[model samples]
Target: MTPPAGYTKAKPGEVFRLKRSLYGLKQASRQWNKELYALLHSLKFKQSTQDYSLYTRTQDGEFLVVLVYVDDILVTGTSTSQIAAVKLALDEAFTIKDLGDLTYFLGIEVHRNDKGIFLSQRKYIKDILVDAGMEECFVAPAPLSTGLKLSPEVGDLLDSTPDVYRRLVGRLLYLGITRPDLSYSVQHLSQFMHSPRVPHLKAALHVLKYLKGTLDTGLWYSATSDLKVTAYSDADWSSCQFTNRSLSSYAVFIGSNLVSWKTKKQQSVSKSSAEAKYRSMSATTSELVWIQGLLADLQIPVSLPITLYCDNTSAEHLPENPMFHEKTKHLKRDMHYILEQVAAGFIQTAHVSTANQLADILTKSLNSSHHHVLFAKLGLISKVQLEGGI
Candidate 1:
């Protein structure tokens, strides 16, 4: 094939040397990224380690976050003039298209209001629901039933014609960006994707039905909330019937806005509530330390002694006290790691009543009332209220 414009012609039986990277080449992405990163660095932008794609430059007390995805870049900052200057710099370096204020990126819809930025995958969810043939299905209050327990033995084998099960689960995984309520249930059903049974398919369909009702639901980042880092950690002992493993879950917030969270079944069984809770706290503490470092790099200063709330008081005490008893000795290693952070003033553990434990939603299924309360704490409000006032 003849070489196109901005390309060198190849000699007989020889490949054309690429002057600039293009898609589908082995090292094209890396080479293009190196060039972009070098240009940003020369413009006094510092790359973030927590998220390497995030680059920032602060001048005259204004902050700009330059998010790069291959050749596409999203620049968010305090001033339009500053953003324009950065765009000028990029234009001078390479061919670029400037897409004004981010409305869509990575499948999530961005909506801004006086309240703050609300992110949702409504269009993506609708598309998936239609693709799965569940667009008209009725919605349920929750993603999974509280009393339902799924096991490999519950249902018949799925059809052997094509791999419909794996494809469905993969699409649901992408839906998790705005629907954290589906995290645990999605992760559970994902285990059987290789050989999904009738029961697993039913459960997965139930999740789709729930999504049908809450298609417009998403995360709201409050503009008025203070930028203070606080986290809630909780665990459910022996929740997994298959492996008898405990589940650890944590939710981190900047004031009232939920920024990050996780739900994962533990590798090993915990004999006591304290052990389970300690493991959960350790996981949250590590995330807290990493977030602190990232914030430091962004020059966003935070107050000392970041607070971590735990529903188990025994676990909270275990970290601050060194007395190693029989019941606590088994968790000595996990205890010590979290305690080191406590002593270093990076994080401090505190006791929270289980009723007020927001992380409970992530660890186990909750009733409607409890779920509503936890969702409120996570900065999720009804779309009607979000649009009308609030």
Candidate 2:
């Protein structure tokens, strides 16, 4: 075929090649990123080393941030004109669509108010519940059953289809974006993805039943809160039935708003409760450092010594003391990275009572009272209003 005007020709008997950019071609993303980087450099925007997707430019003592995810861009600055100028510059170079005031993007529902921006996946949750045939099912009070120790011998499997089990788990994983309460239970059932027994599938459906009752639950960001970073860490010793491995969990907050959290089974067995708590604390500290870098790129300066609260006083004391007991020596070298940060004045460890530890919900199943307390602490609420604007 003959090549069109202003088009580049390929080898003999080949058609004209499509223009290389971020969205269309195989190597388009790399090429478009290179172009965007060059443009930002020309505009005096400095790229962050910690996260390359973040870019910043300062003028007249005011800061402007531009976060790029491929071709999608988010700009926030001290002034609207500054953001407008950057958008105009980008539009001149490439065909751009301005998504004014991000409401929905990348499966996350963004709600902004005078208080702050809140991000959730409520619509996604509703869709998953409807798809799983649980839209009309009775709503359970919790994501997991009380005293339910799901093991290899729970019951005879009813769902013989392995693909159905995988599909259910895949959808549940997406729900984890807003439902951190489901993290441990989801992680527990996900292990049996390959050749999932009938019991495993039943346990997963129980989680779906719980979601049916709490589909509207989500995290809320408060605009009135300060940007102080604090974290809580906890562990459930020997929680896994198959391996007897302990479960470690952590939840981080910027003031009263929860920002990040995790619930995962530890790979190695801990000798004591103190060892388990220490391991969980170490994992939480690593996440804290990464978040600090992210805030720095956004020009949000954090004061020295981020605070981390742990319920285990023994583990807290061990970090400051050089006397490593025989039992504590088994921890890997990488786990000590957090200790180094603490010594360098990057993080400060504190003590919290076990009852007040928000990460407890992530580590183990709790009773209704404790569950409600932790859920409220995590910024979740049940706001039921009458139809007549009651």
Q: Give a tens-digit lDDT track for model 2, residues 32-96.
A: 78999999999899999888998999987879999888878888899888889999999998768
> In model 1, which regions exceed 4 Å deviation?
1-20
Worst 10 residues of 1 by lDDT: 7-16
| Candidate 2 overall lDDT versus native | 0.81
**Can you write out model 1's per-residue Cα lDDT over 22-95, one digit (the tens) per residue?**
87889888888898989999989999988898999888988888988777789988888898989999998996
- Please give the TM-score that candidate 2 achieves against the real structure: 0.87
TM-score of each: 0.92, 0.87
The Cα local distance difference test for each model comes to 0.83, 0.81
